[model samples]
Target: MATITKRSEDYSKWYQELVIKAGLAEPSEVRGCMIIKPYGFAIWEKIQAYLDRRFKETGHQNAYFPIFIPKSFFSKEAEHVEGFAKEAAVVTHYRLKNSPDGKGVIVDPEAKLEEEYIVRPTSETIIWNTYRNWIQSYRDLPILINQWANVVRWEMRTRLFLRTSEFLWQEGHTAHETADEALAEARQMLEVYREFAENLLAVPVIAGSKSPSERFAGAIETFTIEGLMQDGKALQMGTSHFLGQNFAKAFDVKFLNRDGKQEYVWATSWGVSTRLIGALIMTHSDDNGLVLPPKIAPLQVVIVPIYKKTEQLEQITEYVQPIIKGLRAKGITVKFDNDNNKTPGWKFNEYELKGVPVRIAVGPRDMKGRSVEIARRDTLEKKTYPVDNVAEIVDNLLVQIQNDIFQRALDYRQKHTYYVDSWEEFKQRIEEGGFVLAHWDGTDETEARIKELTKATIRVLPVEEIKEQGKDLLTGKLSERRVVFARAY
Candidate 1:
C-alpha cells in the first residue's frame, strides 16, 4: 500500500507514482527503458487489437521487417540521416572475446562484419530498400504493409511509456503509384488515429499537418494528432508522413506503368507509439488515479462484496453471480473482488487507482433492498440502483461515461486555444503554453527562429487553410491564413 501523492500538489511526481503503484510499468535498469507490467500490456493489447482490425479493413497487410539495417541505407537519404544520426544506436561489433589480461571480454576484431548495422529509429530506409525488390509492375503499385515491433532511439532523457529508449509501436509503410494516392493514404491514417484517440482513449486531439521545419526527417509532408495534457503541455499523440518519391528514388523502387514507362513509387509511413498511453493518462486521470475510458479498459466493471460477517459475504456473492453472468454475456469485462483480507473501502480505492470505469458495491443492506451502489470513476459520483435492471443501467452508464470524458477534453481544448494576429500577442500567449493560432511567412528559417526563441514550433498546418488577412507574427510580413503553433512534446 504505497501512499500516492495528490496530483494538485505535484503533477509530474503524481504521474510517476500512479504508473508504478497501479501495476502499469516501471523503470528498468537500462538507463532509458521501462518494463510494462501485465496490466499495462493488457491496455496496449486492446489498442493493438482495435488498430489491427482497422488497418486490415483499410486494405493493409501485416509484415515483419529486419530490426537491424545496414548503416549505408540511412545515408542514402541525406536529410533523414542528418536528423536521426545523433540519436542512432549503432552496432559496431558482432562478437566478443576474452582479453589477454583475462579481466573481461573485449570486442572481437576477427568477428567484425563487412558493414555496421544501425538499430532502426524508424523503418523507412529498410522498408524502402525492400520495396525496391518487391515492386516491379503497375499491379504491385499499392503495397500497404504494417509492422508491429519495438524501435530504439537513444534519448538523453526518458520517461516511462513517453520517451523511452526502446518502446513498442506499429509502423505502416505503404507504396503507391501516384503522389496523390500516397498523400490520401497519409491523411486517411491520420484520421484513423484521431478517431482512435478520441473515441477509444477518450482523449481529444486536433488533426492537421506539420510545418516544413517540424515535418518528419525525409517526409515531404507530415500530419499529426496533438492532445493537451492536464498540466497545460501539448503531446503529439501520433504522426503520418507522406514521402512523395524521395524514398523510391533513393532505393530505385521503380515499376513499369500501364504505358510501359518506368516510374518511381510514392511512399508513406505513419505510426502511433506507446506515448499514447502517456497522453491518455495525463488527460483524463485525476488526483485519485487513472480513469480509463470504458472502451479500452481491461476491466469495465468491478463488483466488490461488502459484508460484516462470513454469512453475509456468501449472500452478497450469491446475489452478484447472476448479474455478473448477464454483464459478461453482453461483452462486458467484469471482475468480482472477493479477497477476504482487504476491506471493501480498500478495494474501492484500489480499483479506482486502476481506473476501472464502473464499480458496484453489493452489501447485506443493499441486498435486503434489492439494490446496489454503483460508482462512476470519471466523476466519483455514486447512485443506488435496483438489481432488477442493473445490467441495462450499467451498459447505459458505461456509454455515458465514455462520451462525457471526450466532451470534457473537447471543451478544455476549445477554451485553451488562442488566435493571435501579432507577434507580441503570440509571444505573450505562448508563454502560458496552449495552442496559438498565428500566420507564418511559410519559410523554414522563420519557423526555426520561432522555435529557438519561444520553444514553440508549428504543430500543424490545416489541410484547408483559413482565409484571413494577417501578418507573419515573427517576420512582420503579410500572410493569408494562420497555422497552429504550440510548444510541443
Candidate 2:
C-alpha cells in the first residue's frame, strides 16, 4: 500500500494523498473534475440521508431541477449574474458529426443552438422563474423545495471535493409571503446545517452571519457554519441565504397577499456541498490515514478472522456470526473480511487506512479464551473484550470515538485561534495560522485591503451579536465586535 505523507510535513500534499489513498476520490479525465469512488460516495450518502431527514422534518420537500439553465434567466438577477458570470459554462452547439477532414467527431456549425444554455452553477434563477408560473396567490406563497444534483462552475484551480469544476450538492430554494418568514427559514436551515456538521459529521463549527462583502450575492443575509481545519485554515461547511425578494422581483414571481394586494415573494436559498467531504478529511484524518467519525464512516466496524487453516476459520466464523448479528441489530454497518487471498495483517492495515471506526479480530487463541481483540481507529488502542459482551462494548465505543474526535478538533481550534488588537499583531499572528479574532472597520474597502495583504477573509461573526468598543486593526477606525478571519479552502 502507498504511504500517506505526514500532515505536518506538507498539509496540502497530505490532504490530496489522504483523499486518494483512503479511496475517497481521484481526478477524472475531465479536467478539474473528480471521480468519487464507492467508499467516498458512501460517506456522502450518509450525509445526504441525515440532512434529508432533517429537511423533511422541517417541512421541506425534495424536487428535481434541470441541469441546463437558460442563459437569459441569469440576466434577470444582476448581482447573481455578476457573482457567477465568469464561472458559468455555456453550451452553444448541440450536435456533433464526423468531420469532413476525417479527424474524429466535431461540433457541426449548423447545429448551433437558438439560445445558449448554461450548466447551472446554482439553481436560484431557474427555480425562481419556474416559481413565477406555479405561484399566483397567498396559498402558493411559500414554496420550499430542494434538489440533489451536480453543477458546473468551470473552476480554474480545482481541488477534488473542495473546489471542483463540477460537484454534487443539494440546493434549497424557498419562496415565502413575508420577509420575516423568509429570514426565519434561512436561519432555521442554517441551524439544521450546523447541527449536522457538529453532530453527524463530528465537526465543530461556528455559526454566524457573513459580512456584506462576504455575503452570498443577491442575498440580504447569508448565514454560515465555518469549521477550522487542522492546517489552521477555515472551510465553509454550509450557507443559508435570505435573498429578500431579490430573485422573486427579478423573475416577476409575485403572489396575491391576504389583503388581496400583489407582492413579490420573499426568498431564501441554502446549500451544503460535497466540499463538506474535504472539510471532513481535513478535520480528523491523520498521517496513518483517515480518522472518520463513527457516524459517517461507511464501514463502522470490520471483522477480520485470523486463522491458518479452513477448520480454524470455520470455528472463527461460527463465533463471529452472532457478533455480526448483534452489531447489525444495534444499527452498525459491519464488514467481515475473511478473504484467503490477503493475510490478516494486510486486512488490518487496509481497514485502518480506510478509517473503519472499530475492528475486531477473532483468532484460535481468542476463541479459546472466550475473548475478541478489539481496536479503535481514533486512538489506535487495542483491548480484549469478553466475546459474549463484545457487541455491547463496541456500541458504547462507537459513540466515544465520535465524541473523542470532535473534542480533539475543538481543542485544536482553541489552541490555534488567536486574538489581535493591532495591525502588526494581526499580520504576525495570521501568518502563524488559525482563526484570527480581530476588529474590522466594517467596510468593503477595508475588508478588500486586508484580504489583499493577507489572504485571510472573515470566516464568521458571532451570532450572539457581541458589540465591543474597539478600532479596526487596519484603519484604526471605530469598530464594534470581532470576526473570525482565516485563509480558507
Candidate 3:
C-alpha cells in the first residue's frame, strides 16, 4: 500500500520511503535513533561476516570494551577530547526516583557519582587506557583487536542511517611497536574496506588518504574510501586512521623496545557503520525499489508458483520442488512462495520492491514446455530458460549481476568525475555536483576559503597521485597535483 517517490522528484523523500516501505529500518522512539528491521539487519550481518573473517585471517582478534568511560579519560588526549566534547552524552547520576507528582521518575540528586561517565563516541580513549595495563614489553608490542558495538554521538540532525545518534558498527583498535607497521595496518584495512564495498556491495569507491583538514582528530593520517551516489554526492564509505602514538602517549602506554628502551606504542583505529546502508541505498537503489547486489542480498532467488486453481497450484509446486532442492544444495538463499492469500502478480511486485536479484516464475504453460521465466531486478529484463540445470544458471547469473552492477557504478563515477583547471570551472562543477578534481595551494587557509565560497571539501588525496605541475584554483599558488573535492553526505 506504500507508494515510492521517484528519485528524480525527491531523493531524500524517496530514500526514507524505500527504507520504511521495503521493511529495512525505521526511526525509533528515542530521538535520533533507528530500529534496523530484520531485513536490514540481515544485510548488516552479511557485512560483519565478511569483514570479521577477513580481520581474523589478517591476524586480528575480537575483543570487547566497556561502553562507558570516565569523563577524565577523555581529557588525556587534548585534540581527541576537543573533537568529541560537543557530542559526548554524559551520565551524571546513577539512580532515579519517583517524581513528586507521581508521573515519571527523576534523577536522584543524592545518588550522584563522584565523576561523570561519557557514553562512547569512539573507544580510543578507553581502549588505550586498558592497553596500558595489558602491555609491558616488546613481546606485547603488536595488539590487533576489533569490537562489534554501538556508539552514541548525540547528533543534532539525524537521518535513518546516515547521521543517526546511535548506530551499530565494528571498531578496530590496534597497536604496533613501530610507526611503519601501524601505517601498514591502516592502509591494509582501508584496502579491505575498498574490496568489500566494490565487490560485495557493487559500489565503486575511490580509496585514498584524507587531507590534514579532513583527517580524523588526533590521527597523523586518515585513509578512506569514498563512494559516489546516484545524486552525484560523495559518501564516505569507510576510514582507517594512523594514530602515531597520540593515544599511546596520552594513556602512558609504553612497552620495552627490542633494545631495552621504553617507547610509546604506535596505534591505529578504523571503522565503518550503519551509514554504509545509506550509501548502499543511494548508490544503487532505483525509483521502483531497492536494488541490492546478489552477493549480499538476503533473498537471492525467489520461486513464485502461478496457477488458476488448487490442483494446478499443486502441480506447479511439485514441479518446482526439484529446482528448489537444487538451488538450496548449491547454497543459494531462495524461497518458494506458494501462498494462496497473495496472487502471483502480487508476489512478483513484492519481491521486486524487496530487491530480489532473480525471480523464477513457474506456470502451466512453462511447466508443460519444461521451461521457466526468470526476471532480473537490475535490468528489469526477463528470459526463458529450459528447466535443465536451472540452479547452475541462476548461480552464474547472480555472479554476472554482481559484476555488472559494480561496472555500471564504476562507469557512472568516471562519467560524472570532472577535471577543472580554472576557478570558474571548479565553481560551476561543484554546484552541479560530482567529484571535481583541482589543485590546491596546500594551505589550511586556502582550503577554508574555498569551502567558504563553495560547500565542497577535499574528499581525498589519491594515494597514487600523478605529479602534474599546476596552480591553485583560487589563489594561483604553486601546487604539485590535484585533489578530489566534493560535497559529501
Candidate 4:
C-alpha cells in the first residue's frame, strides 16, 4: 500500500503521490510525456462521452484533421503565429540515415521538404485553410466540426493531465454566415462547457469573456470557464473564441450570398483539454486521497466483502453477489472485492486512494445484523443501512454526494472570492491567492503592468456583468465593469 501524507502539510507532494498510487498516470521515458494508466484513461473516456454528447446536441459534427500543418499555414495569421511561435515543435527533416563513419543515425538532409511543417498546437490555421476550399455559398456556411486529437505545445513545464507537452483534446472549428451567428455559437458552447463542468464534474466555474490581453491569439473575443482549485489557484478549464472574419479573411473563406455578392464567413473555435481532469482532482480530492464525483467515478461504488478466514469468504461472497447485481441494475458501476489475501483494512485504503465515491463494507458483524456499512469518500462519514435497501440507498447517496461536492466547492468559492475596489486591496488579496474581482481600464498595457507586478491576470470578465458599468481600480478612471483576476494554472 502507498504511504501517502496529508495534503495540508505538503500539497504538491500529496498530489503527486495520489496520482501515482491511484494508478492514474505516470511519467514516460520521453521528457514531458505521460503514460495515462487504465484508471486515468477511464476518467478521460467518461469526459469524452459527456462532451461528445453535448457537442452533438449543439449541432456539431465530428471529423478528423491532419496532425501536421505546413509551417506557412501558421504564419498566415500574424498574431496567432507570434503567440504560438515560441512553443511550436517544427519538423525540418523527415528521414534519418546512418552516417558514412557509422557513428550514429543523422538527419537525412537530402530528404528535407521545400517547406517545413509544424505539429499543431491548435488547429485554427489548418482548419480555416481547409474551409476556404470547402465553402462556395452562404448555404454552405456554418461549418461546425470538432476533432478529437493529440496536440503538442512543447510546454517548458509539465504536469500530468494539466500542462503537458502533448495532451489529448477536442478542438471545435465553426464557420458562420454572419458575425452574430458565430458569436452565438461561441456563447452556446461556453454554456455547454459550464453545464458539463458544474453538473458532471461537480466543479463550479465562473463563465465569462476574456480580457483583450488574455483573449485567444487571433480571436475577437474569448469566453472561458475558470475554476478555483482547493489550493487557491485558479484553473482556466475551457475556452470558446469568436473569430470575427479574422480567420475567414486570412484564409479567403468567402461564400456568395443570395444577393450574388461574396462575403467573408465569420468563425469560432473552442476547446477543453485533459486539463479538466486536473481541475476535478484539485477541486474535491482531500489529504486522504482523491474524492471523485459519483457521475465520473469509474467505479461508483466498490463493495468489500470483509471476512476473517477462508471459511467466512463463501458467506461474504454470497451476500455481496446480490448487492452487486442490484447496484448494476440501478445503473451504478460496482466492483466486488472478495480477495482473501488482502486484509479488509488494506482494501479500504486501496479503494480510498483510488477515489471510489462510495465504499460498502459487508463484514461478519454487519452481515449478522442484516445491514452493511456505507462510507462516503468526501465526508469520510460511515453509516449503517439495511441490506434490503442497498440498491436504492446507494443510488440516492451517490446523487447526494455529487450535489454535496459541487455545493461545497461553490460555498468555498463564495467565501474566498473577494471584490476589491482599490488597487492596494487587489494586490494584497492576489498574493493571498483566490479570485479577486476588480475593474479595469480595458487597456492591454494596464493588464500587462499588473501581471508584471503580480503574476495574476484577468481570469474572465463576466459577460453579463461587463454589460453594466463600473469604475477602474487603478486609475479611478470610468470603466465598463469588473473581471476576475487570479494566479492561474
Candidate 5:
C-alpha cells in the first residue's frame, strides 16, 4: 500500500522512504537513534548468524565486556582518547529524584559518584585493561575474543542506520604473543569481511589499507573493505586494525615468555556495524523498492494464492502444501499469503516492495493447467511454470537470483570507477562522483590538502599494491603508486 519516491528524482529521499515503507526501521523519539522493526531485525539476525559462524570457524570465541568505562581509562592512550573525546557520552550522576519545583525528575545531588563513567564509544580501553589481569604467561599467548554489543556516540547529525548515535555491532579484539601474529590476524579478518561482503551480502568491495590520516586511532595499520554505493559515494563496510603494542603498553598487559622474559602483547581489533544495512539498500535496491539478495533476505520466497470462492482457495492450498513442504525441506523460507482481507493483486505488490527474491501465485487457470505464475524480484520478470516440480524450480531460481544481483552490483561499481592522472581531470572526475584512482606523494599533508580542495579523501591503498611511475595530481611530485580517492559515507 506504500509507495516510495523515485530513486532517479532524489536518491537520499528514496532511500529513507524505502527503509520506512518496507517496514525495516523508523526514527525513534530519541535523537540519533532508530527503532529497528521486526522485519529489519530478522535480516540482522541472518547477518549475525552467518558472521558469528565465520568468526568461530576462524578460532574466535564470543565474550562480554562492560558498557560503562571509567573515564580515566581513556587517558591511558592519547590517540584513542583524542579520536573519540568529542563524541563520547559521559554519565555524571547515578540516580534521579523528583524536582523541587514539581515538574519532572532531576539528578539527585546526594547520589552523585566521585568518578564519571563514559558510555563506551569502543571497548578497546576496557577490554585491554581486563586483558592485563587475564594474561600473565606464554601459555595464555593468543586471546581471540569477540563481543556483540550496542555502543553510543553523540553524533551531531545522524541517519537511521548509517550514522546513528546508538547501533548494534560486533567487534573482535585479539591479543597475540608477537607483532607478526597480530598483523596476520588482522589481515585474516579483513579477508573474512571481504568474502562476507561479496558472497553473503552480495555487495562487491575493494579490500585495502587505510591511509595514515584515515587509519583507526591507536592503530599502526588499518585494513578495510570499502563498497561504492549507487550514488557514487564509497561506504566503509568493515575494518580490521593492527594495534601493535599500543594498548598493551598503555594498560601494562604483558605476558612472560618461555625464556622468563616479560614483554608487551601485540593486539588487533576489527568491526562491522548496522551501516551495512544501508550499504545493502544502496547497492542493489531500485525505484521499485528494496532488492534483496537471496542469501541474506529474511523471506526468500512468498506464495500468494488467488481465488474467488472459499472452495477454490481450499483447492489452491491443498496443491501448494507439497510444494511448500519441499521448499521448506530445502531450507527455503516461504510465506503463504491466504489472508482474504487483501486481494492477490495487492499481495503481489506488497511482496515486490518488500524485496522478496521470488514470488509464486496460484490461481484457478494455473490449477487447470497444473502451473503457477512465478516472478523474480531481481529481474522484475515473470514467467509461467508447471507445478510438477515447483520446488526444484524455485530452488534453482533463488540461486540464480542471488548471483545475478551480485553481478549487477559488481558491474555498476566497475562502470563508475575511474583512473585519472591529471589535476584537472581528477577534479572533473571527482565532481562526477565515483572511485578515482590517482597518484599521491604518500604524505599526510598532501592527503589533507586534497580533501580540503575537492572534499575527496583516500578510500584505500589496494592490497595488490599498484606500483607504477607517476606524478601527484596536485603537487606533481614523483609517486610510487595510485590510491583510491572518493567522497565517502
Candidate 6:
C-alpha cells in the first residue's frame, strides 16, 4: 500500500494522498473531474440516507429536474445568470459524425442546435419554469421537493470532492405563498443541515447567515454552516437560501391568492454536496489514514482472526460465527477476514488505514479464555473483553467513539478561533489560519478591499451574534458586531 504524507509537511498533499490511499476517490480523464471509488461512495450513501429521511420527515418529496436547461431560461434571472455564467457548460451541437479528414468522429456542422442548452450548474431556473405550469392557486403554493442529481460547473481548478467540475448533490426548491413562509422553510432546512452535519457526520459547524455579497445569486438571504478543518482552513458544509420571488418573478410564475389577486410565489433553495466528504476527511482523518465517525463509516467493524495454522484459523472462525451473528442482530455492520494469504499484522495495518471504527482479533488463546481483543480506531485503545458480552460492549464503544470524535473537533475549533480588533492583529491572525472574528465596515468596497489585502472573505455573520460597538479593522469606520473571516476551501 502507498504511504500517506504527513499533514504537517504538506497539508494539501496529505489530503490528496489520503483520499487516494484510503480508496476514496481519484482524478478522472476529464479535467477537474473525479471518480468516486466504491469506498468513498459508500460514505456518501450514508450521508444521503440520513438527510433523505430527515427531509421526508419535514414534508419534502424527492423529484428530479432536467440536466439540460434552455438557454433563454437563464437570461430570465439576471443575478442568477451572472453568478453562474462563467461556470455554465453549453451544448451547442447535438450529434457527431465521421470527419472528412478521417480523424475519428467530430461534431457535424449539420448537427448544430437551434438554441443551445446549458448543463445545469444549479436547478433554480429550470425548476421554477416547471413550477409555473404546476402552480395556479394557493393550494399549489408550497412545492416542497428535493432532487438527487449531478451538476456540472466548468472549473479551472478542482480537488476531488472539494471543487470538482462534476459533483453529486441534493437540492431542495420550494415555492411558498408568503415571504415569511419561504423564510421559515429556508431557516428550517438550515437547521436540518446543522443537525445532520453535527450529529450524523460528527462534524462541528458554526451556523450563520452569509453576508449580502456572499449570498447565493437571486437569493434574498443565504444561511450556511462552516466547518474548521485540521489545517485551520474553513469548508462550506451546506447552504440554505431564501430566494424570495426572484425566480418566480423571473419565470413569470404567478398564483391566485386568498384575496383573488395574482401574486408571484415566494421561493427558497438549499443543498448539501459531496464536498462534505472532503470536509469529513479534513476534519478528522489523520496521517495514519481516515478516521471516520462511527455513524458515517461504511464498515463500522472488521474482525481479523489471529492464528498460526489453518486448523487454528478454522477454529477461530467457528467461534467467531456466533459473535458475528450477535453483532448483526443489533444492526451493526461487521466483517470477518480469515484469508490465509495475508498475515495478521498486515490485516491490522490495513484495517487501521481504512479507518474501521472497531477491530476484533480472535485466536486459540482468546477462544480458550472465552474472550477477544478489541481495538478502536478513534483512540487506538485496545481491551480484552469476554466473548459473551462483546457485541453489547462494541455497540456502546461505537457510540462513545462517535461523541468523542465530535468533541475533539469541537475543542480544536474553540482553540484555533481568534478574535482581533486591530488591523495588524487581523493580518497576523489571518495569515496563521482558523476563523478570524473581526469587525468589518459592512460595505462592498471595504469587503473587497479586505479580500485584496488579506485574501479572507466573510465566511458568515453569526446568526446569534453578540451586539458590540467597534470600528472596522481596516477602515476605523463604525461597526456593530464581528463576522467570521477565513480563507476557505
- Best-to-worst lDDT order: 5, 6, 3, 2, 1, 4
lDDT of 4 at 308: 72
Residue-wise C-alpha lDDT for candidate 6, range 74-103, written one tens digit per residue: 999999999999999999998899988998
> 5 or 6, which is superior by lDDT?
5
TM-score of each: 0.97, 0.98, 0.99, 0.97, 0.99, 0.99
Q: Per-residue lDDT of 1-489 in model 3, one digit per residue for the tens?
A: 656999999999999999998899999899999999999999999999999998999899999999999999999999999889999899899999999999999999899989999999999999999999999997986999999999999998999989999999999999999999999999999999999898889998889999998989899999999999988889998999999999999999999999999999999999999989898888888987989999889999999998999999999888988899999999999999989999887887888888999999999999899999999999999999999889999999999999988888899899999989999999999998899989998999999999899989999998879579999998999999989999888
lDDT of 1: 0.91
Candidate 6 matches the true fold with a TM-score of 0.99
| Top candidate by lDDT | 5
Stretches of candidate 1 above 4 Å error? 98-106
Q: Going through the candidates in order, what is the number of backbone clashes in each?
A: 0, 0, 0, 0, 0, 0
| Local accuracy of candidate 2 as per-residue lDDT tens digits, 1-489 | 678889889999999998998899999999999999999999999999999999999999999989999999999999999999999899999999999999999999999999999999999999999999999998986888999999999888999899999999999999999999999999999999999998999899999999898889799999999999988889999999999989988999899999999999999999999999999999998888889999999999999999989999999989999999999999999999989899998888888889999999999999999999999999999999899977899999999999999999999999988888988888887887899999988898999999999988998996866589888988899888988899888
For model 6, what is the alpha-carbon lDDT of residue 109?
88
* lDDT tens digits, residue span 1-489, model 5: 588899889989999999999999999999999999999998899899999999999999999999999999999999999999999999899999999999999999998879999999999999999999999998997999999999999999998789999999999999999999999999999999999999999999999999999999899999999999999999999999999999999999999988899999999999999989999999999988889999999999999999999999999999899989999999999999899999988888888888999999999999999999999998889999999889999999999998999999999989989989889899888898899999999999999999999999999999987899899988889999989999998
Model 6 gets an lDDT of 0.93
Comparing candidate 2 with candidate 5, which one achieves the higher lDDT? 5
